[model samples]
Target: MLLLIVMVNSCYVPSNLRTVVFSSVNNNVCKRLDGDIVLYAIFVDSKFTNPWSKYDIETTLDSIRVATEWIEQKALEDSVDVHIQVAYHKTLQGRVPIKNDFSKKTLSGTLYKKPLWSGVRDIYKWADKIAKEAGLSMPRDTSPITNIKNDLKNRERLIARLRDHYQTDHVALMYFINNYYSDEISATFDISNDNNVEFSIVSFKNPSVIAHEFLHLFGAYDLYLTQYDVKKRDKKKKDKLMEMFPNEVMAFAHRNLSSLNISDFTKYLIGWKKEMPVEYQRLLLKKGYFTAKY
Candidate 1:
């Protein structure tokens, strides 16, 4: 009976968690606070032939350290307690080939022959095109658009597997090489990358991308526009992103260390504050941003 009760209590429910709130006093802008924020870093090692080289390992660790430090510093400013955990695992398959010349290599040689989640081929293709356009050397056997979709699907499975194994509430942040198939591979968010797992991907080259996606996991909306419809807009009431909250983190990509800032808008989006920036806060409030039901 006791074991049954423990098991039942361990299961996750949306209502169990309380809404995060930020407090302010006097004229001073107060820091936002929350309970410990847990981070799990997943690394796919099979992408390289020599996955465990000293230099490679050191570089990976250093990158992880830098990312964690950034998160910690920002969390501190917001008065939120952050607890980060990094887990590394090699892919079951051997190294995925690097695709350079399409003519020289066979399709099999240019592909990462791993079990992919459903509905990822399109994403892999998209990521690949983006990488090519960016003038970066394309990986031999991968497509970012398609591969990332598969990876995100796989990442979701990984989280579910972990949750079932440990019986705990664990949020995952996946770190892996972009399959280079799509421009959209920059970042993404979902309740579960697939099923019961909430996961997001961070491109290995752009570490700060994870920061943006994680904000989504915390229930923030994207402030940037991907595609615009000119016909629907009146000149007078444009999107107004630039006019209000110019310093907003969600408004732009944090590609570098310097661009990272915890703005009032972000604090409010994550339920860390009752009052957010006036310009955008009203919309969020109307959309029930302050309401804890979500």
Candidate 2:
């Protein structure tokens, strides 16, 4: 199992040196700037999702592959030694998600709810059930484990199955939910493992949306302020992304994938850059910012 040991203390890091490591780093699955970061997508169906077909699966997979190519090309121009590997498995059945006035009356009773996760734990547990039965590489089932003996085992098994299949520790698991009639929100939750896998829930098959959410899992932050913004400080950075970098993928996912590219600000968050440029510091943070060492 891969062990992430994080330690933090005040230290002066050299600005331009790629070798200068962080005193404090995020303990998440999508770490490291270089090498292969597996993008293992789990194709799942739901009441709100379109039924999967052989053609839909192939086309969707092709879109995801194209997105990976965009990221790899951007990393190359920026000199970040990284490549994205794609793999996937389709679920045997459709799963339910916890939503207000939807499945709430049933699943909302005891299911965990958090703003960050948006209660995706329910979705993951249900989907893993199918993948596990399919004999595919999936994360360990950590649902309702009351047995004390299995607590530690469940924790270490963390991403055991996925790690085994990829034969590499750096893997970013994603769930691609096919679109039906209504559009669903796409998000990436970084719940740094509490016997769970930190993954992304993608509702649309658009290459831009796929690539944008994938980058979020690795550590990139949304530059454009959205309707989800509630904090006053968050609103302060409103539309700064659009004004500064109109072609940034994180800012506008609706744009053509060829027109969008990753900015230096995103490069730093995903561990591709050593430090943030002084000129672009105010775009996201006001009280200044510390480099989020991954």
Candidate 3:
């Protein structure tokens, strides 16, 4: 009976540890104000001959390291501890079967593919598979991944698989490339409440762009809008908002990190600051940009 009791208690200890660890990890991304966070990064290598030489890859990784270190320093100033671990999956190639790469150069001619979500889903699925093959562990919680749609069903499922394998709620899937792809951009997708960041090879090396996209995973929005884009129905409103946040990180990401800071409104959006400023709220409401929930 004594041995039995000890064994049962030992099993319970790990379960309790998991609960505490996962709760802390989820809170770090979902509603972080302070505390340690672990960011999982997976680098996707391109199979095709690419523009990045050995030196470029080395320099890019160096820049990414600098950006992450900067983030840790900034978080420390706000009493938050951040630790980012980058895993390079060189064995995994950035190619989805039966689909062309989602770039203007590839898809502009006759290589265009329909239902773009399918290709995107393939990328996430491939990442999950490669991570498993590499024997990576992830947090196993499906409940936190909310707001998944039919179009995002595969991505949502992959998120669960990755979390279970990683054993942590905070995970980032980065698709790195070496080719001269069109539109060197960094983006983040919020699926089922889980956020993932993706960037091209060039964007990965840019600290400002990396920081801007990183904040998006935490629910920050872009404050800047180009007036020339006819698709923007609320161009005037966005322009007004940009004026309100002249030096905000999301809006001025093309600039150096030293010249920009995360605005209070962005802080509120990411749950860093508790309350949204009244003046900002009034301006948003007057401009028809304010909604009941962020």
Candidate 4:
């Protein structure tokens, strides 16, 4: 079981916050890779260092357009209907510093030690901060995530508002941070609730990276070797997966989108395919996940 500790008036490490895993992809708001997906982009910039410019925002929008078009094209090739629509909400200034590559401690201390739940909490906390700063009244949801049933009623209400505003059920909250010089890792947070809380914090405006993170919001796992893959067997599997699909978007995400294509494995993950082949079962998630209709 995942232990979620909510500390008050302090930045202390949760004593035992390890043993976290990716929520079932279908549990994310961006459930399927089909139909319409509204990318609710929230642009944030650090006041101390990098700041957002009109040109930067425009370029990032252009990149998002290109990335979405690429994803749509890939979906078409797989005979899946997918239409991406981006909705830029607002540029938040003066308060934006969502930085944490947890090493020995967590955002409060270490990434490795805290893992998914801590990261998820950070995301929620950041979103709450953004909402509060925007003068939106929030209901109390101070409880930590304890079960598959989300305790964060504030998040639910916020998401409902966004959905109603956009007139779409599928909304992927994207936070684009202006931290290009810091070498910060862009992140697609684990699914909090299939109906609402699904988001990615992107640092760069690269089309491929943007598209890769978007796909992750749906279901695609990282095909390339990441620091998260600490197990030797997992590393070997990732290496093999990368070798199998060199130009796969989930594999070489840093590469240009023009050079990359979504693989069958990725297709399955994103719901473009009905089923993942048994041959690649090792790479697919555990049992009870193959059955899906989100």
Candidate 5:
């Protein structure tokens, strides 16, 4: 059983950090210059209808290390000096099944939307219970997303538990399960607030996918446009990504590090660069995201 602790301060906003709220719980938690960031990575052995075994996780450990190393190397390249520590949590099982089957309603073409934050919250709660069973205390400080009334108490409880259990600035979850079509997602909560708990979930142990999703927690946006974007994205146009970002990891996960580099736009979002580049700002504006002069 997970004990719920109420944090007096619903959100903790750092004075030097600025957050942009995409939704109630999803916020861009950007790092300040030279700030030390600790990412607690957990490998979750989930027991869905088609579950992932301990053996599967064991095999994937090497790939997970590769993914984290990529993150550290990228940060170093930009002089961010991020130190990411990957920790393994006890295996979690017998929770609500994450349906692999997708219907048209659950997805808008290639973009998936079935298991929203609500579903993710359920898994988080289960994981919290497991962590507590293993003797971890929930932190008393947590920040709630502004204007989001749905499941606010539960959200607060999970965040508090994660902050205390991980004892780190950030948390990332690698949910290893049976192979599926759509694999990775970054879950960001309390984007514009302090003490935000951000995490990423990967269905499989693909290093490229892990790195891409991990960056999302640190305020990186998807360079590839989905159906949700106002402009129709052509999946067939491989050249579109190469032309725009060349070797950018966020856009071209298949490319090796030698061929890939962090883009200025991503650097700005993740707090490596204080201000957005003029060209990037124009791109965002053209994409229908309003930019207020800072």
Candidate 6:
């Protein structure tokens, strides 16, 4: 009898962790019926010292275009008017001292000073000093240079400038290279990058990381959890189920570009169907060399 009780308790533990209860009713706020939805892609200049290869930039841009087109197509299929503008700017300078690479000790003592490197690192450090002087606390492991609060201010200023110049509430997409701190930061919009548009900093090696993060801007929660904690387990097991999915565009591990596949989950997040063309959707669905969701 004791053994059976212990077994039952253990079984209940996993289920209890998985369950996520929400009191609010499902409003279906994302229903198809709505006014014309507009999305803007603002490509700021690459600021890092290591310039992105022209071919790579073109390739990355093309991929983004394709993804945007896919959303437009889906929107058309659902009879939604989706307008997306792609803006390009070459003047934005890269910010520096890529975080998450060096240890806390290394970052604390290091004084980044050089021509291009100095400029980038200074912006980050100056922000930190300003925040401390203002009596604000910084986030853990966050350097003074890439402080979230400061970055948002910078992005807001940039967005304001862009809006004044363009005359629209355009969604911004800022691109960067090697912004990863220690191969730990997921490729996507850093919280500091928020406020103006959905910022995406894509490392040369992690171009697809942008796709994953961009999906979030559209309303998709992360399906994959390579970093799951047992204590945080839930009853629905969405994370566990996502692991079963193959290594496609949505997953974190596809090497070849052709093997990418955008899942329905992603389509729903970016409001793709509500704002894009049907042809673009079909093209994206069929172009990638991967299997459809079973």
Candidate with top TM-score is: 4
Per-model C-alpha RMSD: 14.4, 8.5, 14.1, 9.6, 9.7, 14.8
**Cα lDDT, all candidates:** 0.41, 0.59, 0.48, 0.63, 0.47, 0.37
Comparing 2 with 4 on TM-score, the higher-scoring candidate is 4
**Number of clashes in every candidate structure?**
30, 0, 12, 6, 6, 23
Per-residue C-alpha lDDT of model 4 across residues 1-294, encoded as one tens digit per residue: 111121112111222343122343445577777787788676765443256777887888999999999989988887788888887654254432233232322222322235656655656666655543332432333336533422233545556566655667787777786654444566766543444465676767888888988887786777877766789988988888989898998888777789999887778767777656655654544443333322
Candidate 2 lDDT over residue span 117-137, tens digit each: 454555555545544443332
TM-score each candidate: 0.53, 0.72, 0.61, 0.73, 0.61, 0.47
lDDT of 1 by residue, 1-294 (tens): 000000001112233233323211110111122444445444333332233444555565567666667767777777767655554433344322222222212222222133322223433343333223222211222434543322222444444334433344544444344333333243443331222233344444344555555555554445554332244442222256545655555555544745656566667555566555556544433344342321
TM-score of candidate 5 versus the correct structure, residues matched by position: 0.61
Best by lDDT: 4
Angstrom error at residue 267, model 3: 1.0
Model 4 / residue 232 / CA error / Å: 0.9
Better of 2 and 3 by lDDT: 2
Candidate 2 vs candidate 6, lDDT winner: 2
User: Which window of 10 residues has the lowest lDDT sum in candidate 3?
Assistant: 1-10
Worst 10-residue stretch by lDDT in candidate 4?
1-10
Positional deviation of residue 103's Cα in model 2 after best superposition, in angstroms = 3.9
